[model samples]
Target chain A: MDQFTLNLIVVGITFALYIGIAIWARAGTTAEFYAAGQGVHPVLNGMATGADWMSAASFISMAGIIALAPAGGYEQSAYLMGWTGGYVLLALLLAPYLRKFGKFTVPEFIGDRFYSGGARLLAVICLIVISVTYVIGQMRGVGVTFSRFLEVSTDTGLYIGAAIVFAYAVLGGMKGITYTQVAQYVVLIIAYTIPAIFISLQLTGAFLPQLGLIGTHTASGVEFLTKLDQVVTELGFRAYTSDSPNMLNMFLFTMSLMIGTAGLPHVIIRFFTVPKVSDARTSAGWALVFIALLYTVAPAVGAMARLNLTTTMWPAAEQGNALDGPAITLAEIDSNPELSWIRTWEKTGLLGMSDLNGDGQIQYFAEPPAVTAANKALAAATAALAAAGPDADRAALLAEVAAATAARDAALAEATIGGVSLAERGWVGNEVTRLDNDMMVLANPEIAALPGWVIALVAAGAVAAALSTAAGLLLAISSAISHDLIKGSINPNISEKGELLAARIAMTFAILVATYLGLNPPGFAAQVVALAFGLAAATIFPALMMGIFSKRINKEGAIAGMLVGLIFTGVYIFLYKGWFFIPGTNMLADIPANYLFGISPLSIGSVGAVLNFAAAFLVSGMTREPPHEVQELVESIRVPRGAGSATGH
Target chain B: MADKSSANAYWAANLRTIGISLVVWFLCSFGLGIILRPALRGIHVGGADLGFWFAQNGSIYVFIVLIFVYAWRMNRLDLEHGVEE
Candidate 1:
């Protein structure tokens, strides 16, 4: 079969399976739809959580980002650190309490805790913010992967993706999604690991796979990482495994992802599907095990991809000459159709190359800025400032300026060896990005000349990654709308059937809004994704933890703390990102240069979390304790024994 | 013995597990991973800082151990206190 047909078949089979599972597992009642009738096996729930948690970011892009960046190992470590760490909070603090409260949704718990409808409403709003922002990104990811592999327009891909999601999720409810997600988990992890194993064997000569990462480069006595650092630095970039410019920011950014991972509604809800609290604990461990399989392999994939690209760029003997064959010319892309993602993406203006020095080919290089470039009219001006009238010392300093500018300009001009410039590649040591981090993974397989099956595996992985997360987010959004908004607030007398219908309607509308945002993603969508973690950490995480752990905290205090955390994090991000991150309206570009105390906008969410804890604690001190009755409830939530399956009202 | 403090024993057993698990969680997450990272810099495993491993892999492994340990100990305690199913 033709490659496209083969890809179509693979995707078709997976979709059919999902739909079939949905049909087989259609939820019969409100209980079944909302919490899978609280009968899901802990192990199975862990698998579903794995699929839910491993969004497009984890499955589709993480390894690529790691592979393509030189500082990938240590810098990108937050992807591992924060994501896994958040579970500590979830498994220990939040899961059991929420499960015991036996609410249909997060906002329900918030409402009961605060003794105010407004507090519940406030929580629902945060849920919408975090979930919608998260879902839209997943939708966009699905569109792109489908467009490329399925040979359809992004809109068509989205429409089909939406329909497939609706069939299983809307019809199947949590039970359907649960079993299908187990299937998806299998598909996704297999697709993810197979490619990793192939790449590892090709690179390291080891088959145990994980150990292959640290296995020596058999031909070269030098360690693989040492060789990588040398090669990247030679091309004018930071060494792989070296620190990023903003270490503290990276740390905070990582922490935000961790806390966010725990706070995400889809992930947190999975724990509740199981029958008991002890089961919940074991399930979390399994979920981590499933996640760790990929997490551990990701760095190796990143390292190998970097090596692969560098080696491809310079197929000749090391250090023989800086320029190898020839850098990729515009004509090559113009002539060949397959080499088009670069050219097509360049129009987005994130990627660009112009003939500098009037070179016929795009001589991309890692070059310094105008201030550093010498002769370099700017450099000459600086030389003039440093000049003593015609003195030899002045001449030497001028020469030094020229030499420095030469180096800087060479760095500034994305370096071209032969046909490939270091800047054109992912791992070039030092240059501002002109490409989305997502592109690195997309480009690597093609760069490596992997077989069609391997390429097809990547396609399936991307779709699965996108679909799994989309289903999870859709479920979260729908539950919030139907369970919290309708049953809890708008129509408390709504029948079970009415609530189920409302949930289906909510999901359909959510898919549409998510689709619209995917196409017209806000400027800071990627940055906002990381920010979702922060919001979850700061606002929702604290409230959930306090609700179960501290009986003395009154509804008023928890409400006040959540409101403070939510508004503060939102405003802080908005002030720099814009009013709602409205591209040009940003008060300042929310980068390290413009940040408060160099705490990256990404990491500021951690501060927000801390503030939430403080505000809640301090505010609680001023309020009367929850009724003594509340203290007993808190005690009941902490223990695993004596609690049976909670029937949600 | 007087009453065997059935209620307190059951709650206490649960609390002991939570307390122990929390300590391990703190030590693995904030302790070795972040705060003690500087102190443990000299310790390296397979090219990464020992703290890095603890943060990334080791701590998670420890969490699993702590959890299983908690489950077993809690199960035993629960039966002793006549709380287990």
Candidate 2:
């Protein structure tokens, strides 16, 4: 069978398995629907949380981002550290305590802790906003995966994805989502590791990618990273292990992702499914183990893929000499079986190439200073020719353009690698123009010439990653709406049966909104990720931390802190990323020079979180202390004893 | 239920464990991975330096260990303090 058939079979089987799990685990009551009856095994819950946490971005885009970074994947370590480190904070500071609080939703804890309905409503708003923004990305990822692998329209794929999530989510709620996510974790991890293992073995002759990353390259007999550093730097990129130019921003960005990861409602809710606070703590450890399995392999995949691409274009780069080898010729790209992945990706418009100098060879190198100056002169001469009317001085203007072109060609020919001039072979500017980051992972197996089934498994894995996270986020949003908003305050008299129906209705509504947004996403759908992380980091995380840790933090303080953090982070992001992400509405251009203290908006969440803590402390110090009963609640949650099944009251 | 003083001591012990674990966490990722990276660059691990390993691989391992240690220590503390569920 062809590759498409293989993809259909693998993806179809995964989908059937998820729907079957949903049916088998159908929830019976609000307890089962919302918190999986508080009986999930810590290990199983950890696996499910891993699936819930590793979205399409983690599975499909992270390695690509690392591979394409200018600092040879070093600058991208912020993501690797930031995402995993947050679980430390979760397990140590947040998860066990929250599990002891024994509530169905995050807002429930906030509302009760603060002893205010409005505070609960604010948390609900933040949860909804964060989860909705996050889910849109997942939905879009699902659509993209389907359009590429199954050859369906993005919209059709989104509808299919929404339907699958709805069947599982709306039908089985947390119980179903938990089990399906466990299965998803299995599929995605297998799919991700198989490719990395193959590529690692091919590059370094090491079975374990973790060891392969540091092992010697079998072909060059040099250290893997040392060889990668030599290859990338020879092509005008920084060494793979170089430090980030801006260390402060890197620190803050990592902190923001860490705080944001802990604050995300969907992830935090996973801990509520376990029986005891101790289980909650250990579950976080297991989740990290599962997540680390992928996180540790990603850098290896990135470095190896980068080495592979560079060597494919410049075959002699690995041997410490690039000038001796001719660039891969266009004719080889057309007929070489190994280069076939390029053609497949080109159809998706994620990869492109052009023979600009028409030398039959496709040169993929950074332009030297002289070539840049020459190209500028050529552009000026060409423009002058256009300005002078066709009737006047046509011959002279044409001659001037020709002279400029020759000068540019001379500059290109003068460029040297390994002290050998490009004059021996006529080459021009870079030809591999558009290598989108998504292609690094999506086309990885094919680039290494792995089998069709491996590629199919990858396709299935990407879809599973997108769908599992989408379901988790949808559950968070719907639960906030149904359990917190409607039942907690709006209709306190809502029966358990009535609340379950409301939860189902809310879930259906949330899925419809997500699908609609996925189908017709706002232009800034990608940019709003900063908004999601910012709000979660600034508003939700600080609030939860303080609620448990500080007895002096009264309702007024918590409310004040969340509002201040939310507005500060939101406005700061809007100032740089456009108001509500509308293009051109930004007050300042988003560049390092314009950034406050060189902290990009993406890294501003840490600052906002600080301000949140400050505001809460200042406000609380000036106000009355919380009631005696509230103090008791804090003391009780701290002990982790007497924890019971989640209840509304 | 335990007396208030015992409860307070248990809380203090938990805080102490947390304080120590947090120090390790900060040192591994932010300290060694970023700030002290250049200082530790001379010590090599395979192809890269100690700092690169900390940034990409070592810190993650430390984080995993940190959580399990905290959990194990906290569980023991709970049992010793008559707070175990």
Taking the tens digit of each residue's C-alpha lDDT, what string does model 1 give over A491-565? 999987887789889898878777766665543233446767778877888888788767778877888888888
Clash count of each predicted structure: 25, 0
Error of 2 at A423 (Å): 8.6
lDDT tens readout by residue for model 2, A84-155: 999999998899999999886889889999999999999998898778767766776776677668655557
Point to the candidate with the largest lDDT: 2
**lDDT (tens digit, per residue) of candidate 2 on B1-85:** 4889999999999999999999999999999999999899899999898988998889999999999999999999999999989
Model 2 residue A275 lDDT? 81
- Which candidate number has the best DockQ? 2
- How much of the true A–B contact set does each candidate keep? 0.17, 0.77
DockQ, per model, reads: 0.35, 0.84
* Candidate 1 chain A lowest-lDDT run of ten: A424-433
